[model samples]
Target: MKAKKTTPQGNKEITDLILDSIADGVFTIDQGMRITTFNKAAEQITGYARREVVGQFCHDIFKADICFKMCPLKHTARTFESIVNMEVNILNRQNQEVPISISTSILKNRKGEVVGAVETFRDLSLIHELRKEISRQYTFQDIVSKSKAVAKLLNILPDVAQSDATVLIRGESGTGKELFATAIHNTSLRKKGPFVAVNCGALPETLLESELFGYKKGAFTDAKRDKPGRFKMAAGGTLFLDEIGDLSKGTQVKLLRVLEQREYEPLGSTSTEKADVRIVAASHQDLSSLVKKGEFREDLFYRLNVMKLEIPPLRDRKEDLPLLVDHFVRKFTEKTGKRIRAVSKRAMKRLLDYDYPGNVRELENVLEHAFVLCKGPEIKTSHLPENLTPSNHRTAPQATGKTSRLPELEKQVIVEALERYGWDRSQAARELGMHRSTLWRKMQRHGIEVP
Candidate 1:
């Protein structure tokens, strides 16, 4: 009888175990590029069975028909060294494009000659999904503010959603005018339709016009093919024109015509296309002022401003500051893999006191900056921007300080802190550096509800 083949000890077993245990997919191919081994993770990622993949050309299985096309294995073979990282699109068994981070190394024999290549990769689908979900959740309803102005806007959103009327959103920059526009689109009857957005300020007149009303083939020097503009692409949907105040007079005339006629002719196209789209225009500058200055057309302003919505700046809605901070903290923590616990009470107070000229966008930026600099769980006053800090311990009150009474200020600060801490009084008190009883007494004095 032939002698029983005995399995080798440590080295081979250790390598196999390590590869199998990794969450990332791992595979090996011979010099001829035929797959030799495939791990379980590889099976999960590519939706291919090991029995089916082994012995097949790696390019065939990966659908990389063009061998020179960003193939990590080819790089490894030429360098005889590991290609540590690269992002590439791979086709799965379903022929879906899958984004993956690939790392590859050339396997060599004792003679220092390359024999084959081994590759490891991680599927990016889960990470991409998580990021999308987090961004959607945080960036949408996460805008913080408790001013009656904002509350009134929120209350009116459902009604606005029910209408197909043109919406003109007005706000200072960084006050989340875009967020409101998105909310309107998402809640509208055309929610299922595409919500195409463009920043009018980002493009010059010619480009902006071309972007809004796509050009036909050979319309311009670089026009190689016909293109559908944002208006056409967003048919039966919503088109968000951010920074609408920046639009040139000529563009305004074209937009006004589209709004009135619900049809437009593409550049260099004789045929007019019917555009069934809802217009949501936003501007940091006052359209009325622009119209008065003759920089903006009165007819266009009236056409676009069928239903108006205004977003208050952050400082005006001090009651919403804490909630906004918490929302941002959770969002940043998830994004950066940090363990930030809370923002300090003193810090919250300072934040409430400051005038946020940059508005909510600025506030988010500050929090993001703080998250980067923060070493501990709690974000303290030191983590905040320098401008937010009080300039002097003792200073005379402003001439108009009487407009904001001390009691009202205290009430607003307490309410903001509570909201920021998700209504947790203990956390709020701890942040305020005051006893719970003291805070309760103050709340009672101000006739503020605890929750």
Candidate 2:
């Protein structure tokens, strides 16, 4: 058999075939930034055909956010450098934003003369969707956590949401009780209806009644017109009463009446309006304890307590710190347009050492503070709040009454995981994203009884 000689045409055809076979979209642009060659993947990703995009301006076809401002091809051309895996957004033919990771390199002639630039981009839409799905597994609406206690609550949320029973949420201040309330409303049949929230503690007794039940025209000195209250606004929807424990006895009686009769009269008005709203009440104070002390109405407490949700404080679910930290970092990075990526080991250690008495809200504030102070890509020890620093606040004491060690924290988390999984190390290891053998070794090291 005679070996056939490869021709220039054959070589060009092979190159085109190879480019078209790749999963990533590939295109080349001339010095003037006009599209020269477009591959099959490029056509599919951008919703533009090869012939249609050929000879057109690259920016017009891509419509990337950085095309006009920070064009990657332009940067490569000027610096004689290459860009690898730069994440960016592009508008397709339908004007929908598509996330893509692009790599750019200079297209040079056989003589090494710069002729054009070539870009390869991979559609990140699927990746983004998968990320969202993974995030959803650990999240409920805006509430994010991976703790067993939270998971147990989340598992029961669907049933709770289906029921129209008044929901009572209990937690410490800044523990995101309102988030849980909102979650209930969002997941409930009243999702499409309005959600009105009122802080009972924020208003005085006189104003509280009018705020909850509204006031008629000329009801009082400030009653210029008939103003609808939170209940009226939340009609056919859900009403979130925050800090309900602070409601005065009089207001409590009125609220209890509405709960029982599903009706209330506006101040200075004889007509009663039907209370059609589903009530979701939240309080940092323990309503049971309040009732025991006669500070809260027992009947009203029982009414609101028909369905209850207890939010664990940050200190109790330290296992969720990493997820929460990442969530906030992304949140603030997008909000502040900072490039901060992650928390430093030292800073994370500092965070892990402290007992967050203020709970999740305080953690968010701490990160926000770090974001403001951090000029670099990562947050450092110096960027943390004063209280989180060693000099300002004493280290959190462990059961031994000394500074808590990372091992102690690890052991606690491991034990919790074991107990959560009914002492099934295999299942607990899977939930912890660790290997079973590794979990067993850790258990042995920590003296955790293996079952």
Against the correct fold, how does model 2 do in TM-score?
0.60
Candidate 2 residue-wise lDDT, 1-451, digit = tens: 9888889999888988999999999999999999999999999999999899989999999999999999999999889799999999999989999999999999999999999999999999999999987665467888788888998998898889879899999887678887888888898999999999998876789888888899999989888999999999999899999889889999999999999999999999999999999999998778999999999988899999998899887788888888899999999999999999989998998988767655787688789888989999999999987656431244244357556576766677678768887998777665444445446656777888865
**Tens-digit lDDT string for candidate 1 (63-86):** 743355667787778877687757
What's model 1's lDDT at 398?
49
Scored by lDDT, model 2 comes in at 0.86
lDDT for each of the candidates? 0.81, 0.86
Pairs clashing within candidate 1: 322-420, 345-431
The residue ranges of model 2 lying beyond 4 angstroms of the native Cα positions read 1-137, 390-451
lDDT of candidate 1 vs native? 0.81
